[model samples]
Target chain A: MENFTTKASAQPLKNADELIDSVETFIFDCDGVIWKGDKLIDGVPQTLDMLRSRGKRLVFVTNNSTKSRKQYGKKFETLGLDVSEEEIFASSFAAAAYLKSIDFPKDKKVYVVGEDGILKELELAGFQYLGGPDDGGKKIELKPGFLMEHDKDVGAVVVGFDRYLNYYKVQYGTLCIRENPGCLFIATNRDAVTHLTDAQEWAGGGSMVGAFIGSTQREPLVVGKPSTFMMDYLANKFGILKSQICMVGDRLDTDILFGQNGGCKTLLVLSGVTSLSMLQSPSNSIQPDFYTNKISDFLSLKAAAV
Target chain B: MENFTTKASAQPLKNADELIDSVETFIFDCDGVIWKGDKLIDGVPQTLDMLRSRGKRLVFVTNNSTKSRKQYGKKFETLGLDVSEEEIFASSFAAAAYLKSIDFPKDKKVYVVGEDGILKELELAGFQYLGGPDDGGKKIELKPGFLMEHDKDVGAVVVGFDRYLNYYKVQYGTLCIRENPGCLFIATNRDAVTHLTDAQEWAGGGSMVGAFIGSTQREPLVVGKPSTFMMDYLANKFGILKSQICMVGDRLDTDILFGQNGGCKTLLVLSGVTSLSMLQSPSNSIQPDFYTNKISDFLSLKAAAV
Candidate 1:
């Protein structure tokens, strides 16, 4: 594969009017795009208002599976953006939706390696939650209560970020996979590490999930951005062609590559993990169709044109 | 590939005296076959003496790379087996010897993700060892002393089991691989997990090594058993015809598969991980040409006086 170079001259949309004129759907990345460490970005509300006034559909897609759509909706509402739970698509939501589409047995128990958001989503989707072995007495209660045991009735494994992972969790999960060859294995995202202040932290789900995949010689169905599953889900939900959707985010790898891989146009903002230098580097694989200084840049352009 | 099943009703050996008559070489597994839980098996010394009396060449080949040949030789010597360092072939030794054969750079630094033994072996073979990032202060010494500070000078990365792996190790190793695309990536083994404590505890090199491989999208040149590299090294070292060698071991996946893949006759012993039930089961791929209850059982079998 050839490396994509970001050319300064190829910057599209001299004004926001041109950008607004071409875009049908507006997709936003949660972290570092709309909010940073719990603080909402400036002009987010006005930006949403402008897009809404122009008849553009807003979708919040995040690689973080730690929260549910309902939780993200509340976070968005708190940030003064008018949004419904359906407009928020967290990785957990994508995972639950994919599991539901597969028609996994409702009575079959799911041993989750994630936060309450993933468990709640799966439970709402009619799956019986079988907590991991480390869940202790709670796991004992769920184990024999189901028609089958962990490895037997575990029809699917839904993995997301879990800070409480240990050896027991890995063993039990591996056992379930080994016993049931046909059982579905799903991971919210495959990002290796997440940024932390003291040091880079293990992005939990991916490591253990990857271990299972390697051991069992199986590949997990990833549900978050850059995987076509989520993009396809969005297209069907919004009834918009992929080309009509515009994915706006700050990170090039997840956000830009997500749109590019999904056949949607991508807009990169200079406010996240990726920077201009990284884009200029030989290693970067992602390139956006459009570039902006910030979300407010596009908003001010739209306002000035109007 | 089809499942392997055991051949039934082979004539029993009359005695140990008749068994060693036709045998020319003796092959042994290191971990469970020779010793278990830090204790040598009974009759091991007697068996070794009897084989030596018959002038059979003895070779101990192991998939475990955590220990070097010197360590294995010392262990075997402690167990009362008259083995020298040259007669023992650990995976680390095979890996180092294989890399040496390829004329890998002697002065360049190799990022090692394995035990001290592997690092020592690589160093003795003329490679400079750069331990994992967790080595912290120890890494500072290696960094300034690195033979090639230039971007392209890092020759290769050698991966094995490193229990103390962290994000920085993975990131730097991945960056080096990205910076030097031509740099070789070698893995001692691809085994996902190795059982310990009678299958109660499981650990393997794949977890850390796999993370780097996954991030870089590069497959490692495996030098452990079941890989032709080890067998080819053995063939070149001993000047033995491939067809004349017989690989005797207990595990079907590693030992018998190694022989079958290396074009050598396979002899499976039931004294270790694999059982008769597994041989009769419908999932095994590599079948042994000869079967024995244990390595000593071969000493009890003899060619008929026809």
Candidate 2:
């Protein structure tokens, strides 16, 4: 609250060194903070190198469930960054971790309403699953007796971003939840929209999850940023004190809220979906500890640069 | 409000004949009221015939958008009843009529997220369409630049009961609504769940509409029961007064609300989704004017029999 009304709160960073003073470990939101779509943001590589030279542990976290950590690492490598899979954390990983913590039975398969990333993580965690692209989601009539119970072994329905999402997948998911006793409903994230293009707003994973939510009349166990689930998963994985870590991202609803819920410091950058007016808006519920124009602005601190 | 607290309000109609003495118009809700699945409910034909002999105008209005009014009339004909297309009203008809009443341009197409009924109705009204099973709704990646704007001439997106709903349809519908200037969003009905089977709850057209609602963050013009749109269409088409009409159905939400909202008498039957306990429950917001075991119970009124 001390710097809530500071001039730098919605503009260029005033003191980059002061912001990083307490951030021993930096947790970054990928799509916006480090890169935009498939392109890396300006000065991101240099700023990241500076943080690495200053002995700050860097971790990349994203709600995108389309790609596994290994796949993300490959993208990072293509951008001239030496990031390993271990440095990457995704909602898919968090979902798998949460299910494992709950001792999800090995015999019962999870009905997936997502892509390959979630499947890879679930498999890595030694859990069997059904549905996804393999489901083919062959168009079926809405009439009864047309769609027979496809999978009786499904004990949970995990929904993420699925481009292959269809009526069949939704029907199967609803069936699994309504029929299977104690069937868990998990969601990677409930992001209403994704900033993929300027022409039109894209339906995020939340839309897929919303379909089930509307039909089943049930809420899902969301395992993503701003949910505290992902925050706890990261805390447990790194064994770090929340106070020593800082969450940096462009969105206030998800990334900044994740930091606030996790008891960590938060920084809001204006290079993505959020704008200066959004930060200054009175109706906004989330307020970050620090604000800046872009993540790359940190590279201007020549002392931190190698 | 005279019988708001009366015991008869929650009980089975003590005098079914007296209760229906003034009903000059009978608006029957198909599915559970007239038939279950494709089979006609026993006694429905005889009861309808009796009502017809009594000089009552019979109109079959259904929220099911899977079939057009012509197709529905054919079903009634097959069941040994003389019914015309004008005597049948469905959500799809209501949707098309609503569009026609508004004079939706014939040049701009309606992007459909429904079945043959909506398509046929739209076509009958001289409107071009770009969705349905014919669209194929080829599964596409959620990534940017992959889903090129399929149609730019869409002026509205009409959602009904579509078993062929896919990510592509959702994406296309969403794009049309978000990108196309002043694209009207319409839904046949927002039925949360349709009781088509006993095995599991089936998602209705509302589920498909829900995806667009979630993605576009917009409310649709719903054209089914309880919307007042369908009631207005029925009233205008038949030139009937609300007070002379009786809405007979099984659900308290759509059917009962439809009658109540339209200033007509309502009867909730136990033959379908709503139970006696549900009617008796104080927590229920909407209450019907009358309650019965089934629509077929009208046949048991020997004294009122024509």
Clashing pairs in 2: none
Taking candidate 1, what TM-score does its chain B reach relative to the real chain B? Answer: 0.84
RMSD of 1: 7.9
Assess each model's interface with DockQ, reporting 2 decimals per model. 0.11, 0.40
lDDT of each residue in B12-67, candidate 2, tens digit only? 66566765678778888877787776677777777877777878898888888878
The residue pairs in collision within model 1 are B19-B301
Which CAPRI level is candidate 1?
incorrect
Chain A TM-score from candidate 1: 0.86
- How do the candidates score on chain B by TM-score? 0.84, 0.91
The runs of at least 3 residues in candidate 2 whose Cα sits more than 4 Å from the true structure, single-residue gaps closed, are A1-12, A141-144, A195-201, A277-287, A301-306, B1-9, B141-147, B195-201, B281-285, B302-306
Reference-based TM-score of each model: 0.70, 0.90
| Model 1 lDDT per residue over A245-279, tens place | 88988777677878877888788887666677776
Query: TM-score: which candidate is best?
Result: 2
